[model samples]
Target chain A: MSARELPLLFIRHAVAEDSHVLGDEARALTPEGRAAFRHHARKLARLTPLRGIITSPLVRAVQTAELLAEAFGVSGVEVHPALLPQRGAHKRIVDLGRERGAGWALVGHNPSLERAAIRALEHELPDKLRKGAALALHPLKNGGFTLAWWATPGKPVKRPGDLR
Target chain B: MSARELPLLFIRHAVAEDSHVLGDEARALTPEGRAAFRHHARKLARLTPLRGIITSPLVRAVQTAELLAEAFGVSGVEVHPALLPQRGAHKRIVDLGRERGAGWALVGHNPSLERAAIRALEHELPDKLRKGAALALHPLKNGGFTLAWWATPGKPVKRPGDLR
Candidate 1:
């Protein structure tokens, strides 16, 4: 009913190992991280109908996107190097979502995910999202987007009643 | 032990009715909102030991802060006009926390809370917080602050194993 064209979900990868033994890119999600993702994925599917999934090439991010793809019944997930934490690929990712003409989920790293959101909405963030947390954004008629809601893993959503 | 000083928590009032017939400032938390707040207050108490509680004079905010004070076993809570949704009182509040040499919780309205976080960290936020959500910020060395964590009402806290 609203002019909001598409919805964007920016999610950070789940927990992973600390040792850079295999290099940061090679590190994967821990057992707990994987289990926790599965738990949260169910709730996410109920809240949003994910049409497409995109993620960074990093092992942990790839793994997180795959789980989401499975949960959302999307056949495949794409990997884009731009989703890496330090990359300046935020605008490109946002453009991709706008072109898709449907809701898409992007799994990436912190700072980057935080920055991407900042870029889209041009609003200030209080902090980097916790691992596995996601922010739902809707594109405004203007070039920017508005944050519709923020979900931290395992927490119920709360919105201000009269403040809006 | 590190250079990080006191952490500041910015929280919104719990659920409230949509009508402004009573005037926005006079509206109170709904029964469900009150119960939900009680549920979250317990979790907040376990996570951090708040040394001081500050709130807006608004009825909903005062109620929310009172619940937090009781849960954290803090003796009393104070009201600061700066916490109202439209004030530029963030720096003063930060100074207050630093002077006190302890972690303090600020409960207030949106836009202002969002603006304060953006000003302090100079980072863009994806969206204004929903009622009952909180962001934890740790000050940076050269002034300003870094977003440490963001917590939504129902999500279980999950941290990356190695990072934690």
Candidate 2:
């Protein structure tokens, strides 16, 4: 696919503490979460490089986006309020990704990010978008998107053979 | 996912010669095709281990299935007439996969394999199933399957970090 036709990557933030004394938004990525996503980001960069990351302002989401940005070698991370956990934020998140064009990763929470993906593909995913996992949605020329690929953390990542 | 809930992988045959004077069914994988799919099969095995491979009786499809079976370490390659490149073969291909349960890869020609995936997910894919690529369909509890992940040949296959 051409650069313009690249899929929009929806990334759910990594694991976090069960509760935050301050609030949910203030909760940050646990050490394990940060380490896990740092690994996943590199694997993801191979499949599709990123231009930049658009992320929820929440602490955990921002942390996740930072790891992704580092792996993709992109410097900027645009924090969007729409990615904050809320009802119907999926529509705006998709709109933002479309506006930003291809090669953009959206980092956010579960239900909303997953909902956006399900809405775009018009199919219910058998597995939940796990922590530190990403789903790619390829844009169709006639409008709408198709589920392209998914990358989940903790899978083996060794090359089978010399493809080149 | 459980062993039973594992996705059914749909694999399009690797590159083949333009035509075989003998017949379409007689056409086999090119040397390059065999090498390329050998590499892809190993990468795929890391994601989902295959118990067995079911393929179209067509020569190219059977060859592709052999490479996959080797990598997955499965002994049997079941040749099924249902995977033939005929109109409406998609339904039968899916039924066979469902009957066989999970961890099975279906090797076949395009259009039919692609159609089977589209029918299962109920969505049109943005891109055609490229040669030497695999699309996974995760089974749901209620009924039907969901698009899980995709693996394409010729991409870089390095882990970004020490994920373990």
Candidate 3:
């Protein structure tokens, strides 16, 4: 990690079944989604070791967090209701990170997480959050976040120069 | 493609030899870069057929563009001097796309391409352009561009519903 940079990993859950069948918040990862997310977890483990993971209490997010914790040998993921599909929850995650003085992986839903990205990094994304996609943000000395790199599930881990 | 969207695929060049040995614009892709780019080209071929590819005159960009053209069976890539490391070049690529009324793949360098992404999509990515990362931008009906998707050289091609 660079001296002036603080890294934050924001991940969206992998694919889930139709929301109509199960309630929106209760949906779980599909078999393929699970398999792909495991790949993401492995890729992530190769990249950086997470000091902490804060995730939504929602089923899918928790599931994603669990896989990450298992992959990185973290104690466990901490569930935060603030990570639920709501506005400004990103702030809470950031607050948690600042309090811990360490990096964190935040797993949550779309639009809101994107919003949190915009608020934290002050940039817009081209589309909605893709299932199993992650954005790595690094804090700037100017008090804003800069996009460090991004990855998608089912993708292989990249080499040093492969990431910006 | 959506009626309201004009797709733009922005690609960075593959790995290159250090500038110390060759002139910056003349540096060629490394063997590893060529192999990785072939994979990316195949991935792009599977995604969508490009109406046109406009690339920087820089050796690396041209090399990357040639690989894309070969993979997609396009006749050839057009050289765009505007794509050379400079300010506001992304706009030129967008202008060309608007003029053609079709999707175009722009091959160029970083910071410049990343700036173009910011100018065209109004989004901030986490880091500098990776050696062969591509961002898909779709122009919205309301004006401005949205990132439809993104891919890296080593990452796998995603299936529908794989991204939530």
Where does candidate 2 stray beyond 4 Å?
A: A1-164, B156-164
Shift in Å, residue A142, candidate 3: 68
lDDT string for model 1 (B1-164, tens) is 32245567888888976644436764556657767777898887777777778777665676677567657766555556567655567665556545543388988887777677777767786555778987777765566666666666786643223123
Give the candidates in order of TM-score, highest first.
2, 1, 3
What TM-score, to 2 decimals, does candidate 2 have? Answer: 0.47
Deviating ranges (above 4 Å) for candidate 3: A1-164, B1-6, B20-22, B126-128, B157-164
Q: Pick the candidate with the highest TM-score.
A: 2
Question: For model 3, how big is the CA root-mean-square deviation?
Answer: 22.0
| Candidate 3 lDDT by residue in tens digits, A1-164 | 64345467888877866652325654556556766777788887877667777766555665576567657766534555556776666676556544543367888888677777767766676445678887777766555666767777655433225653
lDDT of 2 by residue, B35-98 (tens): 7788899888888777777777555665577567657766555556677799889998888877
Query: Once model 2 is optimally superposed onto the true structure by TM-score, how far is the C-alpha of residue B143 displaced, in angstroms?
Result: 2.3
Each candidate's DockQ = 0.01, 0.01, 0.01
How much DockQ does model 2 earn? 0.01
lDDT of 2 by residue, A20-45 (tens): 55456545566567667777898898
Mind giving the per-residue lDDT tens digits that candidate 3 earns over B53-130? 777755566557756765776643555555778777777766654554337788888777877777776657644568
TM for candidate 3 is: 0.45
